[model samples]
Each structure stands twice: as C-alpha cells, then as structure tokens.
Target: MEGNLAAVLADRADTYGWRDRPLFHSGAATYSHGEVHDAGARAAGVLRSVGVRPGHRVLIALPDSIAFVAALLGTLRLGAVAVLTGPELSGREHAYVLGDADPRAVVCGPGLVPRFTSVPVLTGDDLADEPASLPDPVPVPAGAAAYVQYTSGTTGDPKGAVHRHTDPAAYHEAMALGALGMVPGDVSFSLSKACYPYGLGATVFFPMFCGGASVLWPDAPTVRGAVEQARRHRPTLLFTVPTWYARLVSGPEPRAVREAFASLRAAASAGEPLLPSLGDRIEEVLGCPVLDGLGSTEVGHTFVSNTVTRRRRGALGVVLDPYEIAVRGEGGVGYEGRPGEDRAAAAAANAAGLGAGGQAAARIGERGALYVRGPSVMIEYLGKPGRTADALGPDGWLRTGDLVHVDEDGFVHHHGRILDQVTVSGERVLPLEVERILGQHPGVVEVAVIADADADGAGEEAGGGALAAFVVADEVAPPVPVLAEELIGLARERLPEHKVPRSVTFMAELPRTSTGKVRRSALGRAELSRNGDGSLR
Candidate 1:
C-alpha cells in the first residue's frame, strides 16, 4: 500500500503465482503477467530517460493495446501521474487537455507525435528499444496523486478528477472482490476502452487483483466483434453499457449471439439506466444474471453495484459496504437513517396528501438528490478548486447531482440528473422517465427526450417549453412518419399528458459519449421544425 499503483502487478504475481499466465490478449498476440511487468519496467526506464519525474504528469493517448497498458503502468512505476485520454479525441479537445494538464511527457503512437510539438513526445517505438529488465520501482506515499481522469464533458467542459495511489486498491476491494466475486481463471472482457474508469477497472485493476486475464480490442468494439471475441476467448464476465446491451439483443442473430455468450457467467451494465425490459432480454438470451450499477469518473470506479447473489433488474443494487448513500432533498434534507426504512410509513404519509414537512419526508423515499461519501471518491478536480468545492460537500459527502430514490429493500432507483430535470407546464419532468416509457415500444430501439423551447412565443401560454423525443427505430421498423404517430399514441396511453412528447424525430442512432451515455446537451440544440399538425418536420 505504500508503493505506487504499479506494484499490483508484482503483488499479484507473488500471491497468485501467475508469472507465465496470460494477462492481456489483443488479436492474435498475448502477453503474460511477467512479460507485461517487464515491459512496464522497461517503459519506465524509457520515460525516465526522457526526464519524467515523480509528481510530473505523463499524458497517455494510445489505442487499447499492450503498449497503452505498459505506458500507464510505467508512468505509475516512476511515481508520475498518468493522464489517460482516448486516442479518438478531436484535435481541439486534445489541445485543451494538453494545455490544462501541462504534462511533462507524452506517451503515444508515432502518428500522434506531431500533435505534441511543445511537450516531450515518446512514441511506442521508443519503448520497444529499451532493455527488458525490471527497473527499480519508485516508492511513493499511499496518498500520493496517481492519475488524472477527465470527465466525459457531456454537460460542460471536461474536468480532470485526481485520484490517489491507494484509490485503485480500494476500488479493487470494493468492486472486484466484494461485488464481482472475481477469482483466478475467470477471463474478463469489457467493451469500454482503457482510458475510462469503467474500462480501467475491468481491463486493468480487476483482472490484476483477481489473477484473471482481460481481452483488449485495438479497434472500437462492435456488436459482431463483441460476440466473436466472446466465442473465441470464452470469458466468464463481460462489462459494457446499456446501449450496447440493447443493440446486441436486437442484433440480426439473437440465437447465435446468445450461444456466443454461453461462456459468460455474469454481465454488468452501467453508464445509463438499464431498462427492466432490456435486462430481462439480456438475462434470457445470455442465460445469466445482468447486474446493473452506477459509477462515475470522480469515484474512480463503481461504489454501488448489484451482486450475482442478490440481483435487481432495474434498480442499482445496495450501496457497497463501507460506502454510505443518503437521499437528500433539493434543500439538503436527507433520510433520517439507513435507506431501507419502513415503506409502510412512507406510503401512508404520502397517501394522506400531507402538508409541507410530511411531503418532504415522503419525497425522500421517492426521489431526491443523491449524496455519497467513501474512501474511493476523488480528492479533488485538478486545477478547478471552485468546481471541486461545489461537488464535494462538508464532511467528505460528494453531492452527486443525481436524482434518485431508495426503496424499502435498500435498492436505489435512478430518476435522472438534477440538471436534466426540465419544467413543462409548471411541472418538473425527468427525461429518463419519458425515455423509459418510450423504450418499451417495439419499433423504438433507442430514445432520448429533451425540453425544447416552444416556437411562435407559445411558451407562456401552454408551458415553459415543449417536449421532443429523438428516437432510433428498429432495422425493420416502419417509415419515420408512421412510427412517430405510433410512438405518440403509445406515450399517450402510458404517460401523463405533460410527459407525452409533443414531437418526434428519427435518427439513425442517438449521439453518445465514448462511454455510451446519450449526449442530451447536444440533443437540446438539435434543429427541428414543427409541422402544421405539431409533429416533427
């Protein structure tokens, strides 16, 4: 615990005796535990030769491959902070991150060298020439800064969440050991790339902690590629987002795809709410439980999750032990005790239609802002003290800005983000609620609801804004105009009058972040005209 995060490789090799066991696989090549360790040490030497030092930041922008892992661990071995970013980031985004982090050295492929004219650039080819011997590992305090993980920037400019050296160990214990029940001989595959927190946990930390191996795809993971990899590698666990799960179930070959997943013991979903219908489909097809949970870059990895032993279809499982969750109202009134309290009392009070204070308590059991406090949470957002202070409250409680409710069984249900809540006709509406109802339609493959300002200055007369839905239909679905009317009828039957979408537009696919969460901010600005009949034009 006193050493840098790189020590996990050696520690696992010692405890599990997996020196010659495969640790990483991409395409036809495989790297054993010992080989990766040696490669990391050699890469550390290369970084040292380029003047990387303790506390300095080293930007890692490479595809998901052995070289990316080596560069990350090598930086950690030297006590330098590894700044992880996707290789597919736009040039402007790359320039912003480079300027913000001001990394001392950059580790990337030769093709990306031209982007770092101001910084020291060390390509993978440079690491290839180094001696393949273990370099002396640098000793750092357990609380020393280890890495800088940037947020998805779906709502605003991306901010870097700074994590400590001990965070990885904490996440390993909470997620891998406590939640996942991982063990040796279990192969793991993740659709997420190594740059993100979820992928880092699945592909790097969990496997290392449990003495398992991970599959890395150099290219972006597609539905077909995922099934093919599963069939070939025979992994025990798979991690991905809800969007991918939906697409996989709706793919061309459902039976063959299910057969491909026969090797999987459990599958995990996050990044977005997992519709109960979608979860059931996945479980039926994969013949295993689909565990859905929630996590963020600020927490390093998952803090609340469902276990195979006790699974919930739609709800995020009980908060992992040693971590606490509190459902607080908009005014910061939290639940009195543990989340799983008497549901009878809560329901009775709400049924009575009580006054101010009683309504507040009732809402606590139904919906409120979520606050989390735990060891795995980040110390701060690098270089943004004001934003960090806004997120991290007094006494280590992090205001997650998510609207959630805790059921009597201690299960937490996500309503949506507080920022995502929009007022329509003087009533607050959560987009996820609308999207969830629309997602049940057979013709709808994906749906995102946004509040659009009404045209013709009708906002004050009808409501503050109008509700519009961006939808992705099934491959064999009907024409857009026909599907739009069907979706509208379905919404009228299931949702309230205000919640029903006033207009619908079809898209080939909903725009999403790299991690697979829908980009609602982008959808809010999408241009669409209202037809004479109030349908989308």
Candidate 2:
C-alpha cells in the first residue's frame, strides 16, 4: 500500500506525460489533467480552511462533476477519509451513515444541504468559489483508512466496508489495469455511481492509473440517457451491471449505442452472474467481448474475471496471482495438480477422459470454504465485529459464502451459495448456474431461480421447495415449452439430471433491489407462499 493515493495520481501525470490531456469529460465540459490537479489543490485549501485534519472523515455527496473530481483529490491531499455517497440516499440511510461516520464536515450539492444536521455543509459551488488549487499530498500511512462504502445488509442496518488509503492505488496499478490489460489509451465508463466500490475503481482510478479519460454522465438512470452519453463520448471500454445491459439489449437495435462503442476494446459485467448467452449476445451486438468478473464491495475490485485471452462461458476466470485464493473444506486448502507429479497416474486411472475445459467433479472437499487473502480485502465491517469475524478469519482469509471448486487447470467454477443450495432427487444444484443458462435464451431478458414449496409439505415440498424460474422476455414471444425443454436440456448437459428446474414461470420482470440485483429471497418467499399448502407456514 502506498502512503497516499494522490502521490500515485501525480506520478501518473508525470510518467505518462498526460498533464496537458483531458482527464474528465462530460456532455458540457472537459478538464485537463493539469486543470484537475489545480482544482484538487484548491479544494484541499477549502478543506484545510474548514479545519479538516488528517484522519478526519468528510462525507462527500456531490454529483459527478469537475468539483466532485476535485473534492475527491482534495480529501486525499488533506489525508482525510472521503465518504462517497450518492446525492439521493434515503433520508434514513443518509442519517444513519452520517451518524455512523461522524464526519468532520459534509460536502454536497445545495439540494441536499438541509438534510445533514450533524456536520457543517459545504456545496460544490462553494468549493468552486474558493481557489481551485490543492495543497501538496500529506503522507498518510499505508494502513490509514481511505473511504467507507456501504454494502448490502441482510440485518436491516447498512454495513460499511472501510478501504485503506493505499488500496485504490495498489488495486488500480497492480490488479485492475495490469491484470485486466488496461492500457494508457483505454477509456473506461461505468453506470454505477462513484459511491460504490466497483464504480469508483472502474470510473475514477482505472482511468487515472492509465492516464486515460474517464466519462461521467449526469443523467444515467435510463437506457436512452446512457446511450446518449455513450454516443457523445464514445468510450473504449464500458463497466456496467447485468440489469442495465439487459435493458439496453432488450430495447431497439440501440444502433447508436453500438456504433458509439464500435471502438470498444473490452466490456465488463458484474454485480451478478451474467447469463452466458447474454454475454455472447453482447459480444455479437457490440462487436466486443462482455467479460464477466466477480467481486464484492468488501473485496474492493474484481479479483476473478474472464479474460480476453482465456474466455470461458460460465467461469469467473482464474484468480489473479496477486491474490491468494483457496477452496477450504473439511480437509484443508485444495491444491491444483502441479505439473509432472500426478498427470500420468491420473491419465492411467481415467482413460474415458475429461480433457480441456473438463475436470473431475468434487464436493466442497476438506479445504472448508472459499478463503481469500490479499491487499484488496477490506480491513473491517465498520462496527460489525460479529459479522466481520464470522466472515473474515484471523488469518486474513475472508470466507466468501460462495462455494466453488478449482478444476485441474486451476480455473474456479462457482457453485451455489452455501445457504441457498438445494437438492433435487439427491443431486445438489446451484440456482445461479441454471439461471445463467436460462438467461441465455433469445427471448429471455432477465431471470431469477428459487426453491418453491407446497403448503401441505407433500408433493413438491419434499426438500424445502422444488426449483422454480421467473423470467422477463424481450420482444420475442415467450418460449415457455421451448424454454422448459432447453433449460432441462442444459441442466442435463452441464449438471446431473436431478438439478434441472422442475417448473418454469414467465413474469413481466423479476423483482430487483435498488442496486439492480434480482431479489432471490423475496422471490423464494413469494413462491413458497403462492404454491404452499399452508402446512409449511
């Protein structure tokens, strides 16, 4: 971890000789690297004037703008932790976060000024009124906290993932750009707001690290808005979630959207498992690979991904070497077959032969569960020690609830979540895998899979519930029979016969959380209530 993130940005400005190039662009304006550096300095002066000390928390709720960029750098230059939140956080969530962080000051647009009562508020316009230069970087220790981003919480209270000051620079330099093959000229755009970790990394630091341009559109809720932004800016790369992509592709040809992205070298999807067919369709439509990677807010950025060189339909690619990932089970950490020791013995034992892309099947084995140790892991869950310790072990290996297996070639394949796993006719099934396959159908726009139960605990309610599917389709007619047959066929092809969906339902749309993820628990409960005989309840 570097002492401070500002040093990294400054170093990029010098090394890439991009001091004169545009770093931030919007529909109305553009700011060069030198101008951005100046604005950051000025914003730092405003922070200093406000008595912002090193280690102070400054809640920033500015919309994406030049001032937002400056305020970000300003917070870091002052060695302060910036709480990046969207302007439209719910009043209750906003109040809870403000009280939780107890920031020394809160900066936002005038529209949100009245909501923050605990701390004095500063507007972006006010910062612009002040000189637009920042002080030199303060030396923040490598272990200093940089930001606190909230993550999805099942317990009703939002949880914060505290990132180290240096994690951003390290992640951008060592992992995201270097590992993902991001070059100096790469233009990165993200639909997620900067308050989120994925959006921050993809939009802010990814471009800065490579001396590339970062595109931010103020209007981003609708497909048309995103398409307009893309048409105007023509980003070389896009980082978006599955929901937005589904919406974009489901609409008309989106020809302007496609043409704008004609120069796109790479596209990435996250926030959930993208249907492989959706990925293939995106590649076919946009003429670029829609690489899917996996990460959580706690993990900072994507640690596993489907790279261009070695793309796989449903795999989240190999864990980058910088990260130490192990599939732990009852035995211990599973080891990949090292070269020269077991190849001949395994070959002699298995001549029927699974070759390339196929490997021996195994359960969660003695390794226990998925444990990851790396610089990218969050330091803590703010004030939730019980939850933190339950997930993060003493060895710095975080126990991701996901159960997976690394094949002989060391590629990781995701299984169902431990808590959400189901058994059909004695075979364990991962609902996400089946959902991904269902989402590939031409008519299917989105899908959610859940276990359905009958009330009397008889018939289909044998083991909690049988598998049920909820789907939303594009203009194409609902392929109910075709979908069921194809889904069953896919299950048979990729999984044991028992894991296939017993029934499928068509819906106008699957329910979604505010963040655009399908709410499986909601769907599960709804299905149980809808199908249950009432005995289970």
Candidate number of the best lDDT: 1
Q: What is the lDDT of residue 297 in candidate 2?
A: 76
Candidate 2 regions exceeding 4 Å error are 131-134, 154-156, 336-368, 422-428, 453-462, 479-505, 525-537
Candidate 2 lDDT over residue span 1-537, tens digit each: 477787668777988798988788877688778778777878888988878889898999876777787788888888998887777677877888898888999898888888896677888877765654556889887688888888755435777888887777656743465446887677777887776777889878887777888787655467778777777777888888888888877777757667867878888887777777787778777888887776777888877777766668776665664565766554344432322335445334234333223443223222235667778788998878998898788888787777776555545677656766666544556678778766666777787776655322312336433577777767664445665566557656775555556666666566765455677776656433322211112
Candidate 1 residue spans exceeding 4 A from truth: 131-134, 336-364, 454-463, 526-537
Cα error of candidate 1 at position 156, Å: 1.3
lDDT values for all models:
0.81, 0.71
| TM-score between model 2 and native | 0.86
Estimated TM-score for each candidate: 0.92, 0.86
Best candidate, TM-score:
1
Per-residue lDDT of model 1, residues 1-537, tens digit only: 556778866776877799788888888888888888888888898998888899999999988888898898899999999999988888898898999999999988788888988999988768766653456878897678999999989878999999988888777877777778988788899999889999999998788777789998878778889988888888899899988887888777889988998989999888888877778878888888999998889998887788878777778886775577767764444442333446566555444544234444444356777878887789899899999999997688788878888766677889988888887877888999988888887777778898876433224345557688888777777777788888889899998888888888777677899778898877766475556443455
